[model samples]
Target chain A: MTSPPPPSGHIARNARLGIVLFVVYVIIYAGFVALAAFAPSVMAREIAGVNVAIVYGLALIVLALVLAIVYMLLCRDDADRAEDVAR
Target chain B: MTYHASSIAVAVFVFFVGIVLGISFYLGSRARSAKGYFAAHGQIGWFVNGVAFAGDYLSAASFLGICGMIAFYGYDGFLYSIGYLAGWIVALFVIAEPIKRLGKYTFADALNAKFNSRGIQVAAAISTLVVSVFYLIPQMVGAGALCTPLLGLPHWAGVVIVGVVVLMIVVTAGMVSTTWVQFIKGSLLVIFCAILTVAILARGFRVTADRASIKPVAATQPSDIPFGGQVVSIGNGDNAVGASTGPLGPVQFLQKINDVRVVQWTAKADAAHPGTTLYTPVEKQAREYMLPGGSSTFKGVRSPKLTDKLDFISLMIALFAGTASLPHILIRYYTVKDAVSARKSTVVGIASIGFFYILTLFLGLGAMTSGRLDPTPAGSNMAAPLLAKTFGELPFALISAIAFTTVLGTVSGLIMAASGAVAHDLMENVFKHHPNENAKVGAAKWTALCVGIVAMALGTLFKDFNVTFLVGWAFNVAASANLPALVMLLFWKRTTKSGITAAIWVGMLSSLAWLLLSGPAYVNIYKLDATRAIAPFSQPGLVTIPLGFIVLVIVSLMTREHAKPH
Candidate 1:
């Protein structure tokens, strides 16, 4: 259990955002790996020209890049707003 | 199959090496102070630092090992890229900003910042050194592996060349030159791989006329040969079609691999004749190779055995956890300015790294059908460069040279992290030696020198090994040793100095011990019976990582109030 995540400030908000985004990554990555392990037939099935395994793997990679960008945009904007308020 | 030396490869390799050395010596002048030397005075822009992150993180293993594995094993090799790139998610969301805010020079600095504990300093320092050295072996070995293919030199010569060049780079200009080198190297490596991937898509699958009639092994030898695999007729069939897909889209390119027949080799040396290399040529179904678990190493994904599944899961966990915890990667955050910049840079790294890893799949598959594999099974590390040679000698030289720079970028970061541990963590924090900035900088350079020498020496010692798994072991050690402590320190308030210290040492030693005593080490390194191994499984992360957390939580609970020195 996490220790009552810092009294709801910007840091806390960013941390919460990060944690949620991290979960998104976990879901995508874990789902892909689990599918690979438990469902080879599904993985081997061709979607378009690529196998489900390849599509999912490449998707997970793209999803990570997207997540990183999303996190950066969210936090960077928040950081700027917080700075403006401080000023 | 022995690799022949190419003059073109040698010339191009030398040119790249010269440019890197020139850059290092030139940048050496700027990094006089401790901050400049260790962290580039925190002046590097986020974008460059991020590319350097790609440069630093994408070690020889990623470029050579992953590509080689994919070339040999198919979908299983791409799994490493997935696992490796996945680790960056942890780095980006969790560690990047916090590490930038926490530490100054090294991972130990941030770790000890909260408690100012010598125990934390010593533990973190030792962990950095151990993890760095463990990581260096494969990189150096990759250096050697490339040499045999590019220059026809013995393995040790490549090892020495890389070691000496990297030492010069680190000692001359610690992080400044390293970052720029990595940025340029990282950028070029990505672009080149992208080019190669595009080339692969263009020059797509060419099915052999008699694609179905290849045997996995020509003959089964007595189970005594240690390191030889010779496939009789991988594909003697005439070209049914030329190796060109005529501008197929990426998806179409991957999909087409399932319809082509490829020859993949498996090398196994038996106990009776370890020197006798027995090679089996296996005709792989496109569907099989294009799908996951193409190699025996990743068999756990589909295996019925409980231990096998656990092993795969454990390896994935380690890869997921290891990236944020790696000392060199952690230290890189300190080279950037602020948390936002660090986050942005991490995004850039993720993008670059993700794109490259994606390319590795096509490059590997392209190599699978290239029919240019070194007849010797042991030379898988040269798969990508040799694949490049399929197009032309110039691209081969370029890929090989860039691969060397890949080693340099990574090795320099590792050495920088290692030397920082010695000077910043051990000498300054643990010993409480408040030396002036210049003296500390000087000590760090000397430490870099020593660490470089040590790395170079270690590079020579661990030659001719499958670096992919060795890198996995390094990741396990990093994840077990550093990830738990770092993550807990960030998230948990109850984490005491004692708890952190105990967790690190226990995690480090226990995991290391477990790895050394594991089944693979017994069979592979020691050349002994696998049953003689003490550890039940090869990977120690599933056990040691939790043990680290458990020990931390318990110790933290016990000494919640007793915040004493001892």
Candidate 2:
């Protein structure tokens, strides 16, 4: 923060990207939790072989990893692009 | 279930303890300065530190308590793992880079860096110590849990062993040793947990073919030794017997387990004895056993009662908020060299942690149907280890010992954070007694010793409850007390020193007060009636976390003009 801020568009892009991913994750996770809370029997329903809760739970965990990977790569690209613009 | 310590198991446990101590001593000579002692000279590799993140973050409660809960109750225990792992999102996105950039040594450093307020320093340091101590309780309780079956020693001995070993690790090499211990142990925890899960998949489910009556074991105390129930019948009918499944895949493991019936031990009020409990074996469908509302703790998830639903929601909030705010996890940011490395490590941590949590589903379900676990309500914490007992003694010993080191790693991180609070933050900063690096490290050693002793005493004092349940209290306090101040300071520009100070006190005290008066604590620790508890539920995060944010906002607005530029 002591340093000068990056170009406004660069910062905005990164912030918007980060916020979007975070919200996506929250909704994905919270949707599962909501299902568990309100309509647990729905969670108890079987898909293929696994229960809906198990399937949803596993998906959330896997989704978190994918999103983390996505964020890391995107942030690194943003940082590199900002550095290039400044140079 | 009572266990006799096999010579092989004891030998394995001893081997682990010695190896850990040896690593500590080897690292001791390297950490000479406060930077070396507290932050490992900021020379650690990003990947190793990332793995160390897994080690530091995944306490025994995750391994022992979650597995036990899943083993006993079903899918609800996995709920804790989900919340805990999801919290890393807050840490990775919001805290990791800024924390690395801001702090030189401690969490307090980053917090007070903006204004250099003695008030923020003192308050932040106190907050760190409180959170660390509260977190230490479950780790110590987990140490005892590992000791009982692995060594055949009493629970207190297990608590004392981790206390001493972790103290030596902290006093000797500080963060350098703690980080590596976490790194190695974290790696081992995941690897071995994978091995255990594979073993579970291979073994599948075995039905208890015979109906055996479990006799009264006299009046039960709350912390009574684990009780294993016999297989009364395999399926729904009394005639459904000899139902066995073999080498099932992950999905088949669950579906196949649905029809298997098992006897579970439950504690009931003794008709003859007023103040004592009677142990009774009850037969249950395995399908219901793996459902969300299986345990008394989570029965409210589907309960018609509003209080139960609120309790569930409150717990979820605490778990979500706790990770970003934890002093132990926050301090790990300093171990890496740069902000990028910090983020890298968090990603690695999330992946590693996420993988282990997935494995816990199989492990818990495995333990649930392992036919070895004591199906008593209280024995859920021992699920993973006892499940390991199904295969052989060697795996059980290794799992128990590794789980014990899980405690050791987390507790050492905690003690390091707490010692830094006293030695670096309180003494060097708040009091203006700027000791040289050597003196600071020496003071830290003494402080670590003191904190370790306190943790041992508290761990022994609190028993009879699952380690995960105790961890919920710690998470609530940390999220409520620490997260608001840190978040507002970083984002909300109006945050003033006075506001930070007031929020910390208000948040910390209110959560602690609510905890003491909550039903669980009143019934367990206070030896009083839980019904008399004034609070609506046990968890305080729902009310207190929001309160912290609101208080900081109001106070900061009032003091906005007084805020000086850095």
Candidate 3:
């Protein structure tokens, strides 16, 4: 019962953009998870006395940051409007 | 028993807490209004709020637990960082704007905006308290851990000190003080960790293996019948030490520190027998850490069983989903001016948090090969701090202080959150009692004190558990109880007040149920001589997260006709 008012086409459009971004996130993350499973040998490497998981783990952090930035872009308008109302 | 560096660290930490509490006392004067106490009069800037998000989010778990995990467990520990960062996606996409638009103060405000139903209030309030307590446990535990090296106190004293300090922080100014504390700590944490990382890279890895001789234990008992045979008394003195007397007798344990070799050890079973020792070379330290392209590697790329896959998958799900659900983190959005700033701040947070996580991978890997690891499970948490100490005692002292501040900032934020729930959601909203913001602020202050005390008690109670492992349980509960209701409320049209309330109850109960019934909690908490557990696995995210969504959907469907558009 407490859902916010529906967005104009703009909000829907933004949500759609979000869906696209989520799909991209899924693909990238899935690929990594799969690699961690099926071809660990090919993926594994030693750098600075640390193992492959550490390297890939670093990449995941970068991925999350980039995705977060992407998310901000996708939802900027709806978020702006919501902020205006909140103020 | 004492050193100047450790003393200085404790003094600095105490000084920092004093400054924060002073600000809270000052803010307490102005927080007479509900808006002033709960939302900072809705006046905080996006940047401050964003930094506060970091301050609130990077609790003891993120700083101490993750770092310690990496320090001891190698790459397996860093997987947590990946999971935590992934959760921001849910915050950005699903929860951010809706939460800002719908309600005024607590999460209950958002959930009950549509129906004005008391049920929603009670359920959401209870969930908030439960999740807050769970989250509180790790922070208190972390506080205790920090105190040992910093103040030369037992773990329980640290918990008590933090609880008292946090109570003061919450009682004095509510969100105003909490926000600034988080902002300062967040900036300090990021900058210091960056500096530490740079130091690690510049110094690089080195071999520092040390060996000690073990006292051989006599296999036979001493008796008059034995001639020219050895009688094994407790062997006591080592170098300049005193004699030891114990049930196991005087058995000397030897620890070899081989800094050059990053030996990842696993206990393997003998094919023909039940118990044995099998040592294999996981990888060389130099080759593992310093790949030609600059990356580290782990052996178990593809875990064989469904349980392995689920463990990995469930951890990821919790980390990604848990961020948006955390009570303290969500409150930061309220402190900001508008949704645009919230988005922008989140972007900044992502950048800072992301960068630090990358550094943790290096930090963890560095500790793994430093030969400073505490081989005993009980001592694993010391790996990171000890690694810093290995570089220099001052750095260790500094990092330990920062880590303690990390706990302080987060615990204060959480107390602020819980106090808001009691003062704003239940007292103000449910009871229909109007307290001027000042009166409400007073209520919030008292609530913070009570909650802080409870948290201290729980922290002392659960002191033996690993701080990192305890945090995972907190995440699991938050993700289950909070995330499903939040996402469905924002996106699904058919979601009714009844549906939201049901989701909160079911999601919370089921996850807590699964966790309590699972092997880890049973063995760890219950102290029962039980058999292997009923569930396929212990962690509940794989089961309970989906269950939350399912309950929300089904309840929404059942109550669709009753649902009204807000």
Where is model 2 more than 4 Å wrong at Cα? A1-16, A77-87, B212-243, B269-277, B375-378
Per-residue lDDT tens digits of candidate 2, residues A1-87? 232243355444544566688788888877877787788889989887567887887888888888889988887445634443463
DockQ measured for candidate 3: 0.42
Q: Where is the poorest 10-residue window by lDDT in model 2 chain B? A: B222-231
Q: What share of the true interface contacts does each candidate keep?
A: 0.61, 0.35, 0.54
Query: For model 1, what is the alpha-carbon lDDT of residue B239?
Result: 44
Query: Between the candidate structures 1 and 3, which one is better when assessed by TM-score?
Result: 1
- Residue-level lDDT of model 3, residues B1-566, one tens digit each, is 12223776777787778777788888887776677778887789887887778888888887777766765444556667777777776677667766876778888888777788887898888888888889999899888877876788887998998888877777677788888888888998888888776666555443332112122222222121111101111122222222222111101110111123444433343455443333232334332332211211122234566564565566566767788898888888788766666667787777777777776765665566554554333345555666677678777877887888888899988888888888888887788888775677778788888888899999988877778778888888889998888888777777777778888899899888888887667677888633566655667887888888888888888888877654
Chain A TM-score relative to the true structure, per candidate: 0.77, 0.73, 0.65
Every candidate's DockQ is 0.46, 0.40, 0.42
Give the per-residue lDDT of model 2 (tens digit) for B1-566. Answer: 55677677788878887998899999997679888999999888989998999999889989999998887778889888888998888887777766776788888898887778899999989989999999899899888877877787898999998998898888899999999999989999999999998887877666544554345555555345334534454453544344556677877776777777666667677788887666666677777765688776777788987777878888888998889999999888898877778878899999999999999888887777666676454466778888887788889888888888899899999999999999999999999999888998999999999999999999998867898988989999999998999888777766888898889888999999999989988889888898899898888998999999999999988888788666
Best by TM-score: 2
For candidate 3, the docking band is: acceptable
The residue-level lDDT of candidate 1 at B48 comes to 97
Candidate models: Cα lDDT each: 0.81, 0.83, 0.69
